[model samples]
Target chain A: MWDFIVERRSQLLINGFNHVYLVFLAVVFATIIAVAIAILVTRLPKLEPVANAVSAIGLTIPSFALIGLLIPVSKIGDGTAIIAVTFYAVLPILRNAVVGLQGVSPTLLESAKGMGMSEFTSLYKVRIPMAWPVILAGIRVSTQMSMGIAAIAAYVLGPGLGTFIFTGLTGYGGANAFNNVFVATVAIIVLALILDLLLIILGRLTISKGIRVA
Target chain B: MADVATAPNAQADARERTGRKRGPKLDAEQLIELFGIPLIVVVGFVAFAIWRNTATLDSVETNALPWNSIWIQLREHVVLTAVGAMITVVIAVPLGIALTRPGLKRAAPVVVGVANAGQAAPAIGLIVLLAIWFGFGFWTAIVALVLYAVLPVLRNTIVGLQAVDPTLVEAGRGIGMSNLMVLRRIELPLALPVIMSGVRTALVLLVGTAALATFINGGGLGGLLNTGITLFRFPVIVAAAVLIALLALLIEWLGQVLELVFRPKGI
Candidate 1:
């Protein structure tokens, strides 16, 4: 294992970086899209159940299946991988964002209206800010989930350390096979922990003092 | 309805949520979920069937598209999910109950913390590592699936049991119910909803992860996908993916049904 590390030190670093980068990129896009759709659902209200049901169904589809399903259309590349990661990433966040935005107390919104705040202003100044904590929670979940899904997406030639796992699988009986998969697995676990810690810190720095859980 | 004039949407949202918690008693939203999932699966399978029956296939596609092999793979996948979930429940629920008991109460969070950390490992990585260690096969996949799924059930079981009202347990004891009786008759029923929800989640997780079992020669619809991808056969890949997705949906639907059926009557 030590020699294996020495042999592929730079390649390991690049794969690890790519893994984080892919998940991070997909998560950012998912958060934005989910939040926007959540806002719309909240505004319509009738769309709530539909949105919930859609998310439930969406989340049910396995990442493996989704990656395969997309291959025909997206043709087995980073596009398919990113799309699949973003697809899964969106659901938990969308559900949370919907709940978060709707969780803004009705009285508070009315108060914002009484203060001469416009609809947009109230949503911007009150609704979203108030919902930030829950949305951030969703983002955290999405980020973590995306990390795993992105690993699987590597089967489709997606950028990531998952290549090591697949590579290890291909050479199953070889001396370095276990170490290869082991390194990717450990690297992914470490990355996931680091990202989760970062999200917690982000929540700390961003959550309003008034609503801080302590 | 009267309050709707004042707070139409939130009132509806609250009612919707409450209706869901109240369980599948003909509520519109619940009914939609109850029926909508199966409807999607039915339609998906129909499409898959039509394509499978009619599509012109190359020699590679023809070789991969046999019904016998597909059925075998499907059976393997379902068995992996079902058995893995059953074992997970057996182990996780009992352990969870033990943890919440007085003797093991303090260990609950520590166990949950460790399980949560274990979850950070990617599913594919875990499966591959385990396969390498255990050697590739169905049992290896089952073990991987069990490890991946146990945390949710365990966590939910502890949380659910802890949430049971202590006074109710005391009441049972006050009436000469033994500790075990209080647990069986009072606590488990009250906690069933939460625990069952966790079980449902674990079931779904098992379905998803079981697809990865094909990597270790565990034999599932993923074999079709592996064949398709490696052979560059589009039909095979799509069929495999869709079938796997459909199976997952069906399992999710079955889980919801079980959760409703096993729910203690009064609660």
Candidate 2:
């Protein structure tokens, strides 16, 4: 077992890094888009329902189907995988952003307005700061969810930790297949734990003390 | 945070408005607009997919499309998901209840933390490890699916049960019901909606993730997806994708129907 681990250490690291890269890029992009849409919908009350409806529908579509759909237009690769993962990650982030913002008291918003703060200023300076905890909660959910889904993207030939998983599947019957898979699984799980811990810590740091206590 | 800042103001407003009638019930038209537009868009996408695939139906015979293969595949998928979902419910509901117990608050996060780690572990990775340990096929897939599905069900069950009114539980206790009786007769029923929402979410997620079973030779719609990719048959791919999405929507709709039929009166 020690020999096996030593031999496969590089492969394990590669797989781990690949998984992280895909998940990170997907979450970052999804966060940006979700925040943008959240801002847009909150600014225009009429679009709130529309934005929410779209997010709901987006959530309903399965990850495989989303990736499969992209294959026709984008071809199968990391690019398609990233797009699918991003799409999958969007709803939680968007929902959380909306929830966090809407959760803020109307009076505070009104006070900011009364004080002549610009809408953008009120959003960045007041709404977002106040909403950070809720928003981070969403991010925590999305990060974990995306990490799992992103690992599966390897089946589509997207580069990630899933490679070992798929290779393990195909190489079933071989002596090293089990070892490869075991290593990969441990690596993925460890990576996921690290990411979750990081997010929790980030959530603690960014969210207000009162909110954290709550 | 804003709520803390604005509570005094809201209290003043609340007092002033105490004599006024509440606004009209949520508008049906607006509700329709909220849910309908996206439903239409998704349906449109599905229709387009069906049309595109059907246009090629003449060139390929039905027998060649792996219809027989789908039955074998679906059996594995369904069995795995059903079994996994059952295991998840079994473990999660009990754990959820225990966590909400008065003495267990400190340990609740630990349980949830472990479950969160389970959720974070990729389906592929979990499936792979199980396949290695359990030697692949049905049981491995089931284990993977269970781990994947457990967090939502457990979390929701805890939240739902926690949200139940403490007064109601006290009332049950006052009326001479034992703890188990109160739980079964009162708490479970009250928490059913939220718990079911979690179950619904788990079901949908399981259906999607079950596709990964193909990687482990466990079989499912994933077989169709894999075969399509390998054979470069776009129709097969589209068909599998469409069927999976439709199944998710169908299940969600069924959940909605169940919710309506079972919802307590005057809720």
Top DockQ prediction, candidate number: 1
Per-model CA lDDT versus the true structure: 0.83, 0.69
State which candidate has the highest TM-score.
1
Which sections of candidate 1 miss by over 4 Å?
Answer: B1-28
Which has the greatest lDDT? 1
Interface RMSD computed for candidate 1 is what?
A: 9.1
Query: For residues A1-214, could you state the per-residue lDDT of candidate 1 as single tens digits?
Result: 8899889999999999998999899989999999999999988999887887777777778889999999999998899999999998887778778878988999999999999999999988999989887777677667777888888999999999999999999999999999999999999888888888888788799888898865
* TM-score, chain B, each candidate: 0.90, 0.75
DockQ, all candidates in order = 0.39, 0.32
Worst 10 residues of 2 chain A by lDDT: A48-57
Q: Give each model's clash number.
A: 0, 0
Error of 1 at B242 (Å): 0.5
User: Model 1 in CAPRI terms: which quality?
Assistant: acceptable
How far out, in Å, is residue B261 in model 1? 0.7
